[model samples]
Target: MGTNVTVSLKALLLAGLVVIALAVAYLVGDSRGTPAEAASGGGETGSSAKRSVTVGGTGEVTAVPDQLGFSLEVRIIRPDLQDSLDESGAAMDRVLAELADHGVTEKDVRTTGLSTEPIYDRSRNAPTTLRGYRVVQRAQVLVPKLEDGGAAIAAAVRSGGTAVRVDGIALSVADPEALLAEAREAAVDEARAKAEEYAAAGGQELGEVLTLREVSPTYAGEESWSEASLSRSYASDMALPIQAGEQELAVQVEVVWRLAD
Candidate 1:
């Protein structure tokens, strides 16, 4: 009987040991997470251990415009539609010839608008009456020679006579690459200065650049001609005065630098 009791106690102790081992194994597996969680980066990967600073910089360049753009129109009103068209066509031909003589190439002149509409004379008490047929022909002109812009406009007006209408003119830079390069250099220099100041304030140093990117530039304050400011009738023989004023071009950039130890 004593031997049997001892054997039974050993069996029970072995069973209890097996149970404790299984419980410990299950707890460890649960703490380690599931298979799916392990595949999808469940734990702290510590990828963002490196510190960096991002800063934005801006630069501007003021340059004189080198190109001129303007529009001209010829309008004639007559009792007959054919007469209106013929008169306006002849006036436009004169204007084009004058422009060609002044250095405007054929490619630089484009017929933008042409129409013939009936003119209505409206009164407060009377019914609207058809006055005449109005014909209009418009052309967009670009002059590469900035100095001769006023002369070209005056010649065109003189050739077209009193029927000619001069619209607003806008000045622009023909090639902006050189100015853009200068502005970009300025922007990068400004960014570096800002980064250095920030690094000093943080009690650290700037390391090599991690990333450099250019932001799309916005030219809001740049000066340009407005229709309301320059649009008018051209009936006089006096020369039109043109000024190729300075315009502002801007560039912006975003830069990231790693923090040094």
Candidate 2:
């Protein structure tokens, strides 16, 4: 009887201790909360924790073009392929010499095209008869000084005679590093201004910039003069009249800012 009573008492004490330990564990867990709750800042929502605004701005810089590009071609046809090639080559040589004398460097003159093709007769009575051979030589010249572009072109045409064809003339900015930097600064300033305005409208303070990215820039007024237009505008004896007009470079940027309370 006595041994059974002692065994019962020991079992009751062990069960009581386990219940007290479980109650303590429950109290501690309730105070600390779950891992998910802690990660969510104890009840803060995602939207309230992170607030931001994105804006885009554009900036443009204009300056006169300082460089000129010329696309020149020399074409000739003859009864023999060798004769056609020789004539085309000689005309191109004379044009290149004239360009060099007019301050164009050797490196700036590049041969872009050289071809010899057989001319075909398309008469209804004959079946694609070979009439003659046509040879073409083309070069691109870069004139550093925009003012000398007309003189250089005229000299080349005079030396190459009627065989020389002025395909195109393009004007561009030779060095745009400083211009690009200034444009970028202006773009960022515009973006920040927009962000601040938006923040004020939303009744929030503008915080630090979270992200910034530059989009592809836009260039305006880089016109290419066509061959037909050139011929119509200028006479054979006169130098080609070129105007170095203003060109604009634009930069666009996207900025993201975190909104503060």
Q: What is the TM-score of each candidate against the true structure?
A: 0.69, 0.76
**Clash counts for the predictions, in order:** 0, 0
lDDT of 2: 0.84
Q: How far is 189's C-alpha from truth in model 1 (Å)?
A: 1.4
Which parts of model 1 are misplaced by more than 4 Å? 1-48, 124-126, 208-211, 216-238
Residue 19 lDDT (model 1): 100
Please give, for residues 94-146, the per-residue lDDT of candidate 1 as tens digits: 98898888789989898999998999999999999989999999889998887
Lowest summed lDDT window (length 10), candidate 1: 224-233
